[model samples]
Target: MVDADQTFVIVGGGLAGAKAAETLRAEGFTGRVILISDERDHPYERPPLSKGYLLGKEERDSVFVHEPAWYAQNDIELHLGQFVDRIDRAAKTVRYGDDGTLVRYDKLLLVTGAEPRRLDIPGTGLAGVHHLRRLAHAERLKGVLTALGRDNGHLVIAGAGWIGLEVAAAAREYGAEVTVIDPEPTPLHHVLGPELGGVFAELHREHGVRFRFGRRLTEIVGQDGMVLAVRTDDGEEHPAHDVLAAIGAAPRTGLAEAAGLEIADRAHGGGIVVDERLRTCDPDIYAAGDVANFPLALFGTELRVEHWANALNGGPAAARSMLGQDVTYDRIPYFFTDQYDLGMEYSGWAPPGSYDQVVIRGDAGKREFIAFWLSQGRVLAGMNVNVWDVTEGIQKLIRTRTQVDPEALANPHVPLDTLTS
Candidate 1:
């Protein structure tokens, strides 16, 4: 039976918050649970926002992570369209804007995820300039694309991250001329390293997408409140009918900091600090998903991964810890992207200059290959394009820390399954 006196209040109705609430119930916590979400709609998956949903291939209803009736059946109090104004840790109360209602909690979970980092350059507030971080943003962008049609539209995307690449793919599918600009030498170079990033760069180029590497957007020129062109740092102006900013996201740690919790700076310099159990400095409050920089046992470093798998898996780990269960949030980070006709999967983490060896399996020219990164004889990371099974096998190898003869891994004839044992 749930303790009637204990009430678990979860803030931010995104995937992390919703999953935490569900896990609490699954773990036999019968306490009164209240889930507060800023969005009017129930929690939904966000990965599709830059892909299928933006392209109109998937409906909004299909993106929902869970149904409203499911929450009701689970006895979860749903507080939709509510913004948490402040958190009082001493009083254990949350001030929110739900018809001026105040809610208190015995235990609190902060799953408030990050928002898109916008370019502060000129003309950013123009009608044609946008950012893709929320459902509404994607919907608005889709509407513009549909209205403009395919014939004579141009989309200039800022940043070469997953979102920018996915949007570039979608825009090209709509027959729009797409150009992606980034300061990095290649897309995802910081995470995937330069060689694998070069493969991706080539992949996008073959799809008729233009790339402006080592370039940064200095200003957005607008006429009558609609963006007309983008001025780069090199003083060159590129005409663009639409502009989408997908630079990256910063952690939403205002609530945690307001609660007087010690917020440590990320090793990579922009995320929040949390322990292995996803607990912040204040033990009573826990943070997960994109907002928390949890320690990665595999890398022996604290990192913040904004991937779908991390949010889904880490949320429950935070909830279990809150329930007094000893659980550690450590897993090989994984993320996937759909570009053109190919699906790419990435597992584990290895920043640039960390990996000592890289082995390419299969054929990159054929667009089906697996790239493996090894550090000190341990599999540190793997990237697969149209070769998911190979990536899965690599994941197991990384998890088990299995040592393999470097030459055997590079040979195409060697079965990946052989590494499982």
Candidate 2:
């Protein structure tokens, strides 16, 4: 076991790192704790950046996980706005910043998180083109997007995953003439599957957002270092005054990879490989959140969920593992998203194309339903859309792996508790 008097270092300024720090303190660790972030702001949540904060509904301070004073009060050292260049695993230290400062650690947790996948097309480097990943990025976008909406100006978004869809909804709500471009026939087709993915596409269509499907991005057209349009392989040009590239995220695994840590599968978003307890190949090193491709015991799969709930749950679990506690991070995956009037919560892992049937309750047209994806009558995954307060029941049904009647699952007259009980 690492000595309690030695410093336990955590790298990354996002929710995962912040929560890990909080866990260390809460678990009565008397050791020195150092939380480092590349961004100047304290650790904060990223979910609100695309929705509420982008829409001007939430304040900047509200997004932060902890106020600036919390670090000082807890005796945790803070290093902000500095690049973490390297991890010298043999020396048991992390070397960072232009100054080459070395910080020794008894144990280290790398919650480095992921970066927005870049568009390698022309005009991406032009002015008025943006990527919505950080608070600073969202802060810059909010005013411009709102102004674009007010002026009826055009905004083109590349890719149609969660970020792309949510930003389209938000930019449209803020009054920008929004158009989403993706090569896939339907948005979120890979994960949500074609049927459910079409529902989100229709939702955006109903809200007056345009989409360009079956077309891959060729180049971003620009004039005077500013975006004017986006060109796709289909030879179609989309007019735009501003552009957002939300193609998805790639894990920031350079530091770990350079340090010779076992990396996870690149086909599955490539992250540092960690066991169920979030321990890496190096016993003194650990990982969690978006960067840890840990085993999902629930579905007998290896997946890293880049969602708020995973970080919130995985951080504490990793901390417990680091403390020499007998722990297995077996929590089922869960995530929720808000777009316009629609809200949703999803739980459980549907192993890659393994669901045998999809049973839905309530009205899809009315946008109120609970969708269950099952394999041979066993619930594999479940999602509740615009339905209030049933996540716990849904998660329980998933955890218990209960086989149920599709008729019972689809019946609104039958309470969810009845099926699970």
Candidate 3:
């Protein structure tokens, strides 16, 4: 039975918030769970925004992390389409939308996620110009993609990050003429490095996708308030019936910052700083998911991971920590992406450009391989591309930090266990 007087308020109705509520109830916490979300939809998984959902492979309901009735059945109160104006730490209250009443809470969870970084270029707000971070954005983009059949629908995509490439792949499948524009000579070079990034670039190229690399969009040319084309820095203009900017996202930390929570500086990913337990400077408040730049005890570093796994796993950990359970959010960070026929899963965290070399155990030409990032003969991180049932082995190598010969590690005949040993 839930306690009548105690209340636990969760801000942001994303994956972390929904999971936090579920965990609180499953853990037998008899306190009120009030989930507040500015978006009207039920808390949903966001990965589908670029892939499954955008491609129409997933239904609208399937994108939701929880069913509509789950909250009511579990006795979790929901405040959908409502924004939180402010958080008063000293008063232990959350002020509702401007002029709304305060909702008192014994404990608070800041699970607010990130938002797409928008372009400041001219005509960005015009029709047919899109930036995706929400379900509504993806839904609107569906029409533009379908327009490919009506006429020549040319899509000009800005940025070549994970989301950018995935969206490009999905758009191409829909028969749109996709062109990816980015300042980087190679897509994903910042994350995967040049060698692997080149492979991905080749993968997309073989599939008929065009790339305008080493270019930046200076303006979005428009006609009668609708986007027509994008002008590059070098005075080159590309025709665009629709434009999608997948530049990146920034952590939504306005509420946390307003309440005087400690936020990490740019060097540490610029998110709400929390300890290993996901507890903020104030014991009464905890943060998780994309907004929380918590310490990684295993790697001796801090990360603000905006991936599904971190949000899915960190929610329960934050809930347990809130219930005073001896907990540590110290799992090795992991993330995955899909483009064309290539699917990749990566585990472990190394500082920016920290790995000295990468060892490959499978054929890159065939796109079936496990690539390990090694520093001083020890595995620091690894990724498996189009390889099956090897994530466990890859993660173990990262967790154990085992030193292995580069030659053995690169040899496919050598069993993964033997190389680690």
- Using lDDT as the measure, name the better of candidate 2 and candidate 3: 2
**How does candidate 2 score on lDDT?**
0.89
lDDT of 1: 0.85
Q: Pick the candidate with the highest lDDT.
A: 2
Stretches > 4 Å off in candidate 2 = 1-3
> On a 0 to 100 scale, what is the lDDT of residue 101 in model 2?
94
Q: Return the lDDT, model 2, position 71.
A: 90
What global local distance difference test value does model 3 have?
0.88
lDDT score for residue 119 of model 3:
90
Model 2 agreement with the true structure over 50-98: per-residue lDDT tens digits: 9888888998889999988999998889899988889999999998888
Clash numbers, per candidate: 0, 2, 1
Over 4 Å off, model 3: 1-4
| Residue-level lDDT tens digits of model 1 in 39-139 | 88899889989888998999888888888799999999998889998988888889888566888888888888998888989889988888887888889
C-alpha root-mean-square deviation, candidate 1: 1.7
Q: List the residue pairs that clash in candidate 3.
A: 3-30
Compared to the true structure, candidate 2 yields what TM-score? Answer: 0.98
